[model samples]
Target: MIRPSSLIFAAALGALAGCATTSAPRSGAAVAPYRDSIDLAGRIAINYSRDGKRESLSGKFTWRQSKANTDVSLISPTGQTVAVINVTPSSATLKQSGKEARTAPDLDSLTTQTLGWTLPVSGLRDWLQGYATAVDGKRFVATPANDSVVTRDGWKLDYVSWQDDAAAVPQPKRIDVTRIALGQQVDEMAIRIVIDPVAQ
Candidate 1:
């Protein structure tokens, strides 16, 4: 699992956010919850930080019963592996190099802390429908719990292109994000997630 702390990423092209130092997984074990609130599955693009530069990668998460049961593989632009996390409801495991590391609930905190980022659960769900809510503390166009526009706490994220999707929620791909603190301009970080899936 990624050691949650700070992260340093050199994305395809963008500014970096946080930094972290970690060793590869030792054994292939079960991956536990990074948080108790969610389990997710979908094809996603993760954009993050390395050496203060933004980085991007694509992968899929398979989760069930509050446990992530999936084989996720991430490939760096250079064609090398950053890491692969295999998560299960009860336990977690990772395979790096030739060794595998298996652990329990530790995997959850470890991954997020190691990566120094928050996995995009809200984004992933909304991505399917093309709408998402921001974390309560994070800045955005609005809130979810008490926002006037929507019943949710996150921003009233909407996608209104010249065309619309047959699906009810617009795909996050086309939707633009405006930080509440900021002006009309969309947020670079949020937009980055919209175009590409990444941890917040």
Candidate 2:
């Protein structure tokens, strides 16, 4: 069984937003309009080596985030509900198709206790919008000229493609992430995300 915590990427999606700063546009660059809530559907893949064995998972996900709450659903390629996660300011809950729901104080603690690694909870929300906030709290915006950033928070991110190259500020369509681990706490791990375009 995939350990439940391995599937808590949804909690990371709903991580605390109080720490996030709105991205500032670089001179002459445009940014997507800010919305109080965001809804997205996409593909996600995770690969990692543990106990000398390699494991991988790939699936589709739907995410809904608002100021007050966030809900995420992980779906298998065969269209089965793999897991569902709900997160709020105080707690996070994960429920798989046939298992009891698990709760945690936050994603970092949950994943650390279960997976021996940390998710980029501090930076993921910004990353989804093509921006990043490093551990020191500096913001990096993605542009064609500069598409990769080492977040200094244990991961390196690459904005592989954009939704519209001709737009004033292109939004990320695909993102690649790799672990930057110093010790055994994190082994070789990689994640790739491909975001679906918003429906008209």
- State the C-alpha lDDT per candidate: 0.32, 0.69
Error of 1 at 59 (Å): 9.5
Q: Please give each candidate's TM-score.
A: 0.37, 0.83
Per-residue C-alpha lDDT of model 2 across residues 1-200, encoded as one tens digit per residue? 55543464444433423234576645554667545588988998877676788877788888787866667788877788777777677876777766777778865665554456665546666677877765455667777777887775767888898888678868889998777766223566677889999887
Tell how far residue 80 is off in model 2, in angstroms: 0.4
Candidate 1, after superposition: displacement of residue 189 in Å?
Answer: 5.7
Off by over 4 Å in 2: 1-19, 23-25, 113-121, 181-187
lDDT (C-alpha) at residue 100 in model 1: 46
Q: How many backbone clashes does candidate 2 have?
A: 0
lDDT of 1 by residue, 94-166 (tens): 4454444534453434445434453322233222222223344331221122222221333334443312233
Question: Poorest 10 consecutive residues of model 1 by lDDT?
Answer: 12-21
* Residue 96 C-alpha lDDT in model 2: 72
Model 1 lDDT on a 0 to 1 scale: 0.32
Against the true structure, what is every candidate's RMSD? 13.0, 3.4
For candidate 2, the TM-score is 0.83
Q: Count the backbone clashes (under 3 Å) in each candidate.
A: 53, 0
